[model samples]
Target: MTRRRTTLLTGCTALALALGTTACGGSGPVTAGGGDKALGGQTVTVAGVWSGTEQENFQKVLDAFTEKTGAKTSFVSTGDNVSTVVGSKIEGGNAPDVVMVPQVGVLKQFAGKGWLEPLSETARKSVDTHFADVWKTYGTVDGSLYGLYFKAAHKSTVWYSPGALTQAGVEPPKTYDEMLEAGRTVSDSGLAAFSVAGQDGWTLTDWFENVYLSQAGPEKYDALAAHELKWTDPSVVRALTTLGKLFKDEQLIEGGQKGALNTDFPGSVEKVFGPKPEAGMVYEGDFVAGVAKDQFGREIGEDADFFPFPAVGGGEAPVVSGGDAAVVLKDGKNAKAGMALLEYLATPEAAAVWAEAGGFLSPNKNLDPAAYGDDVSRATAKSLVGAGDSVRFDMSDQAPAAFGGTKGTGEWKLLQDFLRDPSDPEETAAQLEAAAAKAYKG
Candidate 1:
């Protein structure tokens, strides 16, 4: 789970920073019209896990917030380990006015510790109006609203190089078998079929989740996530066995197991779309497009494209997702300013700016699909909204951090082992169950 958290936490730390700065007057959709004096002369400090390009983009958003609300604002980078930094700040009695929590589990933990402030009426109205019920539900703890999701990523996508697919004489795979065949075709053509980021074990967890959700359906996913069902259940075995199809074959993955075990996530995407193009495809969340463009200057639809993770055994596509939530600390110095920021983020305008910038998706139903920068982003946005209530939060994210966020332990290490030697799903399942039991008990 530590690896999972890093994969998502690092990838999204930038987007979270990008959206943390924007705000407007309380009444309506935030526009570039003008400033209001509501929270004027007040400064709001936001602490979040963001840096680099995300930090720069957030500055622009904050500048917009300053222009629209007349509230002086600044953002603080909380580094990679947000929970530790935030907890220390709170204990020091200097908590940021607002904090962007990366996972719902963390938000709930904060709420249980009485460190978060429930949303004010103004923020509640904005959330109710702009977001879907599910998003609201995720942000609520004990029937009180404490967090608002400003950005999200749909994880059910497999990014591919269209040119490579064409060269392999295959279309986007619709079924698991077809996907395997497509991999075979690409491999036969002397290219690695998929870039498995085995070095980052979280990607492997994602690989398992998508297949499980689609193959076993949402009820089982929910049960498994809530620990109502054991990790050693037959469904998990089926999911692992299915995923093993790709992991077991040396030629199917870029650089084989060794290459995968060494390549980090960004490198995995680059392997597929980099200059030499070692592989044809990579599976990750919607954020990959932005990373590719920003890092390697690859054109999404032309140089790279994506399809929903193909269904396993003829089931429908499953959407697994993760996002950042804006939460007010109980000791917030400027409550009005914090609520104003949340109100603004709940609008389509705030989402549009980040969307056009690339690699952001909002659950705000008020957002126009056209706000996304390109067809690839638009498709992901559509898939998210289109999935409706069927969408499931990323399984590892929903689990307790002990099992989900611990490094070189629990799911993270076990999955890496499974990838290195996928000969035994049963043994891996037993290991997973034992780790989960101990973590959940703790």
Candidate 2:
């Protein structure tokens, strides 16, 4: 499945958020702009990565919190790759009350470093019945909250142009051979099929990840992530071979395997929404719903839709990569308000708002799948309904910072590069093993 870009974010593609640290974590009446009540009506600074539709949705949560608490709140647009800035503030003793990021593993490292606080008793108790396994295990380490997840988004789902597929006489693919045939048909019709962008290793990594999930089960990925399994597992080789074949086929990718070398994320996005793009099918996350709606003037399900990533034989599994949890610093002067906003995000109403704005998946399990804005969105929600309930964090986040967190630490790059030449899957596996072994301090 195509995952959206989250890291290596530069100066605010409108996402460089900048809220203040509010009050230190110690004891003191928190301060707000004008008159104040609890915590002395103090204001709290929060930071996270969200600009376009994402920011609008988040604002809804903030707006509700302000109305309920009567606390004045404003935000600075923090760019992606939050750790670069937030991590420094934390080290400098001035981290914001709350921080939002996309990858769960990054937050786990911070929690492990002792930079976070356990969720308030009220918050922790509320989450047990409200979230899925992904949020619980991915966000928590040592039973503490580093990531306060608010939604669920899965990849490994393919979004194709139904009309194009039909016009090209290509049926929705159900098997690996069918998928290849579909791609070929689309190509023969002078239209692109897969909208994979490999210039940046991130997109390519997603392809490899999807292959791994389809070839093996979630258990294989989990074991590999934890360094309990070797990368050269037969399943791994088969998946890589599949990807390599696609790259070898000029008809499979837009601009071919080499074309992926220069494809930027936004560019690939445009290829889908723009009138004359190379491809018609893109495997992306919920976030793209807005991009399609606003840019292509189509709401999810109505304009664009998604289908489960097809598996070969008994390779079916429910493997989804989701966002990081929102965590509040323990000492921020307005910890009370921080917690309030954090909890506010978990509500059904908040989930609805997020769905409305950015088309992100909601962590609030209470959200009615019926509430999805379009057919595509609803279909995606429905696809997950019949699958197992387990969600895996993205592989990139499972390693130490040196591997990939606030930066591209080469963990995913290896997968992307090796997928094109999978003959030596064992060697590639060995490299990942060695990398993890060297990076693992525990």
Candidate 3:
């Protein structure tokens, strides 16, 4: 159950993509200089934090690139902390030709520092054809698209076993309060209701984000992400108080609070899907479909299903999202080759390589729905495109690295404390406000 960095992409069909049909969006397959030479046999180095299966899948992508372009491509896994390793490389003037930035805030930091190279015309055309205007907006800073999303994920889903829910006589809830009631009912049936990955505090942060956005709505969400509203604001307290209901009810969470806190994200999913299932449900991105299939042999739509996070506090639930962006560095080494790889990635042919691999979602609007590994993935992709303008980026990812991305500090640590003891939202909010203030200032 290692969390893979997958996508929340929109797709077109294989025939449309193969025939160079304008019906898909692009005029033809993404290429560099039409039939131009392949970078004179240069090597492009790409750095990312992906490892394990995710790395394996991306290697397939790189391998495909080599087969078509003949330019050697190398990938460097950045371990647990990409910022630390990437920062060191940048400081030492050995920056990778391209870096897959998992956080938009970090990508913006690099762009602001002038460490990124502007997208070449070929890559720009791919972006124009494949992605939506919103993606272009996010990639653009000061009127230039320095980054393009290579992978995206929809984070507003609660994965559950339909048969288990049916046997328990519990229905997927449409509102926050109903969700709590159903959890209690499932718990009464001798199954824990929610599998929470509290050990990795980012999951804890995601929990808060889904609720906060649902309760407070996007205007407030944006203001708060930009620090225009303090964490001590009333909305923060309200969201935390709502979240406390499940955390405080030990029977509602798998293995109780302590065990839940000890379990990582994948283990949380495993608890819900293992042979003798301990829990009935887990909430995460659609990529969990691939995980359940890979680890437990669970079929997505049949064995597992999802519903959007319910509306809370009289407001419509917002679709929370996250993704990885590819940015070429202006470090004067193999820059053209790096851009060429990106241009190729922008094509449906390259995306299909990963799409067929399972667990990945692209932001390409023209990518065919059938290109996905299964119906579950296609449904997730449809939901992402159908989400339209209602989607919002992951809140913490929009905040500065010190406040959100740094492990054991700021939002991560504060939210972990909140999850450990849900009784004092006021105290948690105060601490969160203090940390955000200091981190934003620093």
- Identify the candidate with maximal TM-score: 1
Clashes of each: 4, 30, 12
RMSD of each: 6.7, 9.0, 6.2
lDDT of 2: 0.63
**Against the true structure, whose lDDT is highest?**
3
Determine which window of 10 residues in candidate 1 has minimal summed lDDT: 1-10
> What is the lDDT of every predicted structure here?
0.79, 0.63, 0.80
lDDT at residue 231 of model 1 (Cα atoms)? 93
lDDT (10s digit) by residue, model 3, range 295-360: 999988898998888898899976888888888877636776677677767777777778889789
Q: By TM-score, is 2 or 3 better?
A: 3
* lDDT for model 3: 0.80
Q: Please provide, for model 2 over 319-354, each residue's C-alpha lDDT reduced to its tens digit, 9 standing for 90 to 100.
A: 566665777766455555676566556445556665
Model 3 alpha-carbon miss at residue 153, Å: 1.7
Off by over 4 Å in 2: 1-40, 384-388, 405-409, 419-423
Relative to the unseen true structure, what is the C-alpha lDDT of residue 4 in candidate 1, on a scale of 0 to 100?
16
By TM-score, how accurate is candidate 1? 0.91
TM-score, cand. 2 vs. native: 0.84
